[model samples]
Target chain A: MIELTINNIKVKAEEGMTILEAAKTVGISVPTLCHLKDLNPTGACRICVVEVEGFKNLIPSCAYPVSEGMVVDTNSNRVRRSRKTIVELLVENHPQDCLICVRNKNCELQDLSERYSVREHRFAGESKNHAIDISSASLERDPAKCILCGRCVRICNEVQKVGAIDFVNRGFSSIVTTPYNKGLNVSDCILCGQCIIVCPTAALREKSSLKIVTNTLASKTKYAVVQIAPAVRASLGEEYNMPAGTDVTGKLVSGLRRLGFKKVFDTNFAADLTIMEEATELIHRVQKNENLPLFTSCCPGWVKYAEGKHPEILDNISTCKSPHEMEGAVLKSYYARKMGLKPEDIFVVSIMPCTVKKYESARSELSKDSIPDVDAVITTRELVRLFNMAGVDFTDLPDDEFDNPLGESTGAAAIFGTSGGVMEAALRSAVFLITGKNSDNIEYTEIRGNRDIKESTLKIGDLELNVAVVNGIGNVETMIKKINSGEKKYHFIEVMACPGGCINGGGQPIHQKTENVIKRVKALYEIDRLATSRRSHENEAVKTIYKEYFEEPGSHLAHEILHTEYFDRSR
Target chain B: MNTNVLEKFPQNDRSALIPLLQEIQENYGYLPEEVLQQAADHVGMPLCTVYGVATFYNQFRLIPLGENVIRVCRGTACHVKSSANILFALETALNIKAGQTTRDKLFSLEVVSCIGACSIAPVISVNDEYFGRLAVKDIDKIVKKYSARKVSVSTANENQES
Candidate 1:
């Protein structure tokens, strides 16, 4: 440890630690914009400039290391003036349309300007007039409002490993965009939207589907049926004043009902259905020894990535539609028939904690008879905004139950919000189907956690099952290489696009600190533990639906409605 | 796109990016989108990163250059002497803004940092020929002269073809 004087107070900081990290340890937070934890600091924003004794220039604390016996003044008059000047310059080039911006109160730049008390710009100069890019169905890009912080670029390139956008040009002409300034639709963007969460301003955001939902709710001819995803109940409370990971499932149902939805359903029912189809498919593959490691097809982001980057493995993926997609299909077909309404009259809107689901809903392959399975997808953030717009006090609402039949789910479906939840849920049902009894252990702790890639072998009766669970698409290259080399063998694999799975999905409420993601992950686990039924096959609604409608899993009717095929999109 | 051209460079190494882009730009007058994608594939870099590097330097162009290029210096000396007014006048007369080519492809305008001609106060260079001590009134005459030269060159080519 090295001793230093910070603001006239003597403090000991660890060796090789940056000044910003050391200051935080002493309960002092030096503001930063481009300093993302666990990633290399770019220090391009220069907002964390601090004064040090014997140094002529103010050093960026985020990148500068602490020296022995150094004296640092983080809030000196000189530092204050310099910081204020930087804000002034940034504001001069930035647009003053904060009142109408998407991230009005939540923007980091707006927060910084308010804290620094920046009223007017001192040096007003030429500002770039770049147009917005709204070609992609999942996301929107506005270069005019960008502050050039490079956080979005860093997250998209390094964290997601999908460099669909980057800093183009230099100096005043620099803007973050796709190659040749083309539309993002033509680019290799998987529409995962990880960039939207890390952006400091309204430069990047998920496309708003709120207006369409509101219009559909007011229409007399249409009946707006809504379904909420499993991850949303774990993280949507963060948008309100509630703490992160607070389970607001009951309150969420009440709030959606207040918003004038005809019926409120749970996507977990469809998740249970997915587990039934996927596990049965896995067993069939194992018996035939055709496609050994059957990949999960629940995440739209991972599905699209596989379609684009590795089309050769398209056959290895399960044919089951995602939970929300399956829910929309069931709602339009069975629910519509029961209610005596046409599929066109029933507008299915899904409240998801994912941005890629919006794009997935628009896919022509997921549609039947030229009508989409799901009409619209609103993120958790959008749902929060809708509740606020409708004057619904989300936290104060009374606990209510989801509508019957489609709303009921099992504990295994609730855990699907986390990383290894799918693999665990599948094993619970696969073991029961293969043998005629339940396993001694239910948790299957081997494939659980936030690990990049987890591999395990378990003996279920006479067969030794090999399985792997992967989170974060950035960590998939090595596993793909290993699989291609035939060096590793596995019977099942679960992949989620976002790190930590749907609980930390791209469309969750934006939190500067990443700890909320961990909290959300734990919340889903708690929900799973408290439930009565712990397996997909045990879901009463699922068994009833199979007995009444499809007869069994992977049946002809199930294949037509619950299952789908893949396309060769590797261009 | 001539993707076969990328096989000449070493694959999967980011260090080969600059040289690969330079060769592409040399082969084609400006960097084409398809060619840049090919180069990105060769270097194992993202297309966005390749585009960012290509756009960072003013030496690289994304579109083909016009027949006659006009560069207006906006250095400190020229800016203080009202180079902004001169640039605006040129844009008005040509009906095109800076960093854009005219519809007929006869002329293009660009804003440059400095040509080391600060002694002249305001300088506008056209096709390597420098025009010093420029004024707002001089834009029309310069554009007319270039327009007349282009017409003459086209007529000369027509005569030779016939």
Candidate 2:
């Protein structure tokens, strides 16, 4: 430990900690742009500069390692000037189109500019002239607004292990681009949108389908139905000033009702359906001696990554669409048929905590009868915007339940929001299906946690089942390499693209503190523990759907509606 | 088109084009068009896109016959110390531009964004070897060492053939 004095306040901080970190430890606020917790400190932006008693010039507190007996002035005139100058320089190149930007009020750069009181940019020069590239199905890139903080590059390279982007040119011409400036759709990018989440400015954004959603809602011809994902309930409350991990499922259901939708449903219902079909497929694969190591296909980002980088494992990936898409398909087809409404009249919208879900909805193969499964997709952040725009008092709204049979879900479905939840959910059903007996023990403690890579083996009746769960794309790369080297042995695998699965998804609530992620994940498990139907098979709604509609699990009719295929994408 | 020449190398497995391109550049002087074309066929990529990528990065080249490659540093310290001017002088003396090899098969000139040897500003490297504290006159002496070696190799080959 080291002792330091910041702004005349004596503080004790850990050794090897940066000044910004030490200041934070002492409750001294330090603004930063490119410094993300648990990621490398690039110190590219000079927003966190501070004055040292012995140093000649102001130093960036984010990158400067603290020393013993260091005296720092965090709010001195010199420090303030350095921060202001950095903000002014950033504003000079930034676009003046803030009112229309997707991240208008939520933008970090705009918030910092207001806090620093940057009234005018003295250095008026020509900004970098680059066209906005919306070539990818999920993401948009506006290089003109990029401040070159390298957050996207770092996230893509360090976190995802997909080095599709890098610093290309030098100095003034320096730009972040894929190799040969190929569009992201044509590049090796998996469309995870982790880059979009970390970007402090409007340089990266999800491709909005808001206009299509609004059009559907406006038309009297179509009946707009919406479904909210499990992760969305745990995160939507954060935008309404609620604490992290607050379960707002009731409020979210009521809020969607206020949004003029004909029905408000839950993706968890379809998540239960996914478990039924996926577990049955695993048992069939084990029985038929075909496509062993059945990989979970619920995460679109992981599905895309597996398709592009490890195409040889296509046969191993399960043939099921994600719960969001599955619910869309089911709503437009099954629900539409049951209600005596045309499939075209039912505008299926999914409120997902994922940007890749947007891309998944647009896949050509997802269409059942020349109509896209989901009419439009919106993020939880966008849903909050819609609620506020409609003058809905989200905080004061009464708790309401999701509508009808389609809205019902199990506790196993709720846990799908967090990491290892899918594997645990699948195991619960797999053991029952394999042994033809309900095991008293449901929780697979070996496969449940926030670990990057987790693997376990168990004896289910006469068969030995091995399973592996990978959370983070970078960890998936390591696991893939081990599998390719013939060192990994597993009968089933679950991979989520984000670091902690859909609970901490890229489209989830954005919090600066790292602890908030853990808090949100904890809240999901708590929701799972408090529920009566702890297993997917135990959910009466799921049993009713199968007995009334599909007849049996893994039936040909069920496969046609629930399953999809993957293609190899080489770069 | 010569199978024997192609078979002489094992690392030239067409499946590994990008890495093989880097390796061939490291071993040979530069990536000739023929070598790049062979790599394009191996990787099943169009020759145009391969050439486009080779030209996109400052790291690649398409010429041949350079005994020693010279890379003048252009890091922050070196830039402040006018190392760019040193590079200009080397480009003029060798009569070959940056990322290009001389027609006489003597030297290849290149410029790097950084060498990471900041304390010794105005640095350059010859054939993967570092040379610091460079001056305008140093270009002449550096060129002579490689030219002399090239002359001996050609003469030795001719004598053995005769």
What tens-digit string does per-residue lDDT give for candidate 2 at A102-194? 788878889888998988769999889988888987888898888888888888877887766777666776777775566878776778778
Candidate 2 chain B: worst 10 consecutive residues by lDDT? B1-10
Tens digits of per-residue lDDT for model 1 on A380-497? 9999889889999887999999998999998899989999999999999998989978888889887888789988887877788889888888887877877889977788999998
Clashes of 1: 0
- Which candidate's DockQ is highest? 1
Q: Give a tens-digit lDDT track for model 1, residues B1-162.
A: 456568778899999998888878888978888888888888998999999999997788788788999999999999999999989999999899888889889988999999899999799999989999988988898889889988998999999999
The model with the greatest lDDT is 1
Model 1 misplaced stretches (Cα beyond 4 Å): B1-5, B71-90, B110-146, B149-162
Model 2 stretches with alpha carbons more than 4 Å out: B1-162
Candidate 1 chain A has its poorest 10 consecutive residues by lDDT at A475-484
lDDT, residue B36, model 1: 85
User: Model 1 misses residue A127 by how many Å?
Assistant: 2.9
